[model samples]
Target: MDTTPPPSRPATLTAPRLVERLIQGQATSDGAGVRLTRLLTQDLQRRLDPFLMLDLFGTENPGDYIGGFPDHPHRGFETITYMLQGRMRHRDSAGNEGLLVPGSVQWMTAGRGVIHSEMPEQQEGAMEGFQLWLNLPGRDKMREPWYRDIATAEVPEWQGEGVTARVIAGATHGVQGAVQRDATEPLYLDLHLAPGAVFTQPLPAHHNAFVVVYRGELNVAETLVRTRRMAILANTPGSDGVLLRAGEAGARAILVAGQPLKEPIAQYGPFVMNTQQEIFDAVNDFRAGRLA
Candidate 1:
């Protein structure tokens, strides 16, 4: 959909990673009965280190999202929300507020703690988006809360032969993304490909990666990844990158990769910590009205 011209040089890959397995998101409801699919569950936390959860919410019925997400708390992690359609208003205890429209992104760091609410701004129509949770290291678990709203135009993109890549949080084809994290070195890309198009991305062999196709289908390493499916990439030795080919109907997908922290992960509901004692402290803090 992005008409931006292709970069002069395309990525080169000596060995492309293969799909380890396919995943189907579990149908679930959250945030006041908002229908959604949980792509990354608690069981996969260890496999997808530094990345905790990934939820996809999309619906045309107002009743499904009308209630939206009320005041909720989060700690010891960050939340990156990418709005694909509809408008949602975000308000937090830190006096931060923003309107999330289609193509916009909100990156919030609930380091120490924060209470926030995401409510729909539109009365009727479609609401579609994704929320990805990125874990915080032990050292930064108690850091101050931070938030940012990146407008649609701020997100950098790159176009090639028959594909367009929106770099959300990492470098691709020499184009820097809207947000970058030094701790995790996360790569979040939204790719739109024309029918039969081929796209290549160089990736670090150590990082954990996966691709979720939302529209049409994609072929990776000779594996057919259908729409609404996620393909977990194998971290094979000497693998330098990944090669993706769009199906006949074209495709739209999100490719995410991140360096593993390799640290112990302790989680309880919305609170995440390194140790059980830390989780207890978080619970006590929230109960004592200390968590904001």
Candidate 2:
């Protein structure tokens, strides 16, 4: 893969969105005691429509992530796993298998349903990454299951003055991302910024957006967002985009935005549907061994 940064094409923004709220992730453990932080919890589901959850896990200790995620079932949603460091093997009931390595991404859509597992390929060393749950529209909830593994070299990157952005799911500058979905029109970007550098991204007025800082600190519309914190961008009318400036020490963050489905969201553990009846059906299907 070419390691050179692409040509810069700065984005223009007349009005930048402000941070509506700063969220501190709750320390949590899931998948057989693998430690993680739940940044976008259930309470904020409605506010960030089309986005269900965001979990950040990073640790150098083997005990923190050794067990890994065992067999699990999911329905009516999509999972995007971006690996920053380490290796994880994914296997699904659909017969799809992939290995996620550093800077790789696995996008799996459990449209109707699917059973899967993600286990660490390493017993020691640093493991870091994120798993984002994107809700499927009710109309397409039961379409079909889909999966894809995007290697690190396949993810497109855009370079700016002092920033490098990895476009994972939408267009950034003139570079298109590795994956694109028509319904939600999601935009996912992992940005690395040099000290005191600014990165601007123009966004649709009606789309919902947020940023999660992982390294150092960032300023969004003058609101300081520290490491491990998530900043929800306000949906102020007439706002064109967001402007992110890195703190003196530099910063790395992921910015995600998507068009809201504006549909009723009914969730039950691993199954997300449009109504209680659908949830019950999902449960029944899983119990009867029909959810593959």
Candidate 3:
């Protein structure tokens, strides 16, 4: 049926743009009980479209991080958090809170607005996680607040020669992502490749694909990307799609591909909309405490 989108050669970023990692910066939290950093905010963004923000946090000593994000407010976008290890308990003022273990996924649609919190439940075991922010289209920005909590058993996984992958939010191979919403047809997969392993996945020719390396080293085209680095490949450099491989040491990374929204982006903190007035209205609504 040719349902799959046509694919083209992957494009490489300009010299000023090719990058592999983000440096830690002054820390802040979404609210009183949360922790956030400037991974893809403000000047750090624009590298990826329909995707924003990646936060990494952990509490190894237990006392330092036994606590997690307490109740907070969100609007206009979607939030997806994946647990690599440890247990995370999340609750919202909407009366929804549950624990998420390794390989599990929590997807929230803070359409208009919602208040929530995530905290660590177990003190002994390690606690580590990654959170990503996905923007909503103008038509669906204020639609409604919804959420999806998936257990480790629900998401699909594949293990092959020198590579392993966990499908968190989008499709890959033959299996598709579990969550279905008004997204930009994005694919999110956790990939672990042994040393010197090379792989390539076809992407929609009209879409953009990027890799975010968490551990070890990665090679994007001819660029060398070390741990905590991100590489963006767009416009299809060749008709063959993007190629990814591990460096001397094995590598762990996240691969994301999605169609560009191509819309004007207006974002402020937790809110993202199309126009300035909409942003103003959102601010006033939040300040007035009308968001629910």
Find the candidate with the highest lDDT and give its number. Answer: 2
What overall lDDT goes with each candidate model? 0.93, 0.95, 0.72
Model 3 Cα lDDT, one tens digit per residue, 1-292: 7795443222342322233443444466544444544355555445567777777655466655655666667878888898888888888877887789988999998988887888777868676667888878778888889999998898887555677778775665566777654458878888888898765666666665667787898887667877665666655433446567799889998887666677777887778888889889988997888874
List the lowest-lDDT window of 10 residues for candidate 1.
4-13
Residues 1-292, model 1: lDDT tens digits: 9996545445778899999989999999988989999999999999999899999999999999999999988999999999999999999988899999988999999999999999999999999999999999999999999999999988898888888899999988888998889989999999999999989999999999999999999999799999889899999999999999999999999999999999999999999999999999999998887876
RMSD of each: 2.3, 2.2, 5.8
| Candidate 3 deviant stretches above 4 angstroms | 1-37, 181-183, 236-239
C-alpha-based local distance difference test score of model 3: 0.72
lDDT of 2 by residue, 54-120 (tens): 9999999999999999999999999999999999999988788999999999999999999999999
**Residue 160 in model 1: shift from native, Å?**
1.0
- Residue 59 deviation, candidate 3, in Å? 5.0
**RMSD, candidate 3, Å:** 5.8
Model 3 TM-score, 2 decimals: 0.83
The regions of model 2 sitting more than 4 angstroms off are 1-6
Q: List the residue pairs that clash in candidate 2.
A: none
